[model samples]
Target: MKTYQVGGSVRDELLGVEPHDKDWVVVGSSPEEMIEAGFRPIGKDFPVFLHPDTKEEYALARTERKSGKGYHGFKFYYDPSVTLEDDLLRRDLTINAIAKDSQGKLIDPFNGQDDLLNKKLRNVSNAFCEDPLRAIRLGRFLSYKHISDFSITPQLKAIVKKILDSGELNYLSSDRVFAEIDKAMQNHFPEKFFNFVVENKLDKPWLKDINSLDGFSASNSDLRWVELSCLNHFTDFDQIPLPSKIKKLISIAKQLANIEIDNILIENIDSLRILRNEEDIMRILSLGLECMDQNLITKIVLLYKDIKFAELEKLDPNERKNEKINLLKDLVSKL
Candidate 1:
């Protein structure tokens, strides 16, 4: 049996990025043999084990057959005679299919090294279509790597179009969709993810009339908070500021498109101070309010004060109308 370092660890090491995790492919090994060698079996659908000594994942060389649809519908086959070349051919991307030996000798059975040198993302084989998740994975890889130069191969695009046309994306859970998006957002160039979503028409089912918001591109988290803020009609003055309830408000404000109004509101530093919530402070700052706009800032503070006072009173007939007028006045002042 031969244990080889494989997958992202080898790919990332060549790219000069510290590898996040390590996976190994064990050739000529069986579950019973692994167990005899003191490895713990962990996978339910496939042959995977954990190295008793190193504690790293050690999966036997295997191939998969499509059983149904989406990510979960796959049947795996593990054979001790399957070579590393066979395992690499079954992978999604060329860059990911390459591996390294224990002594650091690189394996290039699929010419992944050439694609890596060209900074390209290419599929390993026609078997790429067996799973539909590759399209999302590729788009996310482009976003995370800030890769604009590389183009998806025609075959891959054809598969992606097929997947989109079939409306199988709706069958995918929101959690899985967000998981991919959240990972993409961790990259510094999150706008690329948004662009990918728009270009591939993936946003149609999830977001309504997304193109109507011109020049608005944001990470999934940013968009979520922004939508929440807008839905709440967040104002600077409330008994409890909405920003205090939402953690990502400042990030959302930064992602907003029509931010000229934010510029005007930020001039009032005192008003922001009185607000006392980080989200409120960010909102005021985003509106371009200055620290020394005494009159404007005082007006904003008074508005919040009145709103809070109205909420405190149980029997003030004009309180509701008065609060509305004050909030409107605050918005108009910023405009």
Candidate 2:
């Protein structure tokens, strides 16, 4: 069997950036043969094996045919006859479809190397839109730190729009969908992700609630998530899957957002039972101070830090809450 390093690793290396992970495609290989050669089987949908020593994934060269409806309905065909070119055709972008041989020779069956040099992001084939997830993945790549400068070709945009029109977006798992957004949140320009989604009409029911920002440069990812979720008119916190902690922060952030700056000094901030932890609420407000430049938020957070929660523990829960609110109002009145 012949092994060739394929996918983003090859593309990234050509772009003069260090590859984060390497993926290999084995041509002229079978599951039985791979097992005999000491590779462990792991793939549920296709024939994928792990090297006993390196533990990196090595998938058999395969081709996909749309058997039913969406990308999930594809029937995979893997055998000794599938060529290296066949596997490349199944990739998302031309830049990602390049392969490097074991001898370190570049294989450009689809001219992905040229696309890489031009700093262009384009689809490998018309089949790129078949998988709705690529629209999200491409958006993530657009916001990637290294290749953020890459231009999305008009052809690529049309294909991605086809993905939006496919009506197969919901076919993807929520975890998979969130996984892309989470990665984009960590990228250099996360706002570009949302913009791209909106530009290509990729923002369907899943991301329709998010209002695209002109610019958002929040350093913290959770804070960034909070900012985006609150951009929606109704703030669809339950529409997307998020960790409980992030959901809590979004809930608190929304509360702070809805409150008029003049009305922050209330009897008890947790009157709605939403803002549970003072520390969490302050954290969200602190980010609000930086991102939104709400000077009132800074004063509220600073005044909160001065109030000693330990001293309030001596009183009952109701009394302690009232005392804390009284102390906050007293401090705000002094300012």
- Give the C-alpha lDDT of model 2: 0.79
Model 2 earns a TM-score of: 0.86
- Those runs of model 1 whose alpha carbons end farther than 4 Å from true positions after fitting are 35-41, 51-55, 146-148, 207-209, 212-335
Q: What's the lDDT for residue 228 in model 2?
A: 82
**Which window of 10 residues has the lowest lDDT sum in candidate 1?**
234-243
Model 2, 14-78: lDDT tens per residue?
Answer: 77889878999999989999999999999999999899999999999999988765557789999
- Candidate 1 has an lDDT of 0.64
Q: Write the per-residue lDDT of candidate 1 for residues 121-240, one digit (tens) a residue.
A: 778887777666666777777755635456676777777788788776666655566567656656655556656666788764543323311222333444444533343343222222
Which 10-residue window of candidate 2 scores lowest in summed lDDT?
Answer: 267-276
Query: Candidate 2: misplaced stretches above 4 Å?
Result: 231-234, 259-261, 265-294, 305-335
Top lDDT hit: 2
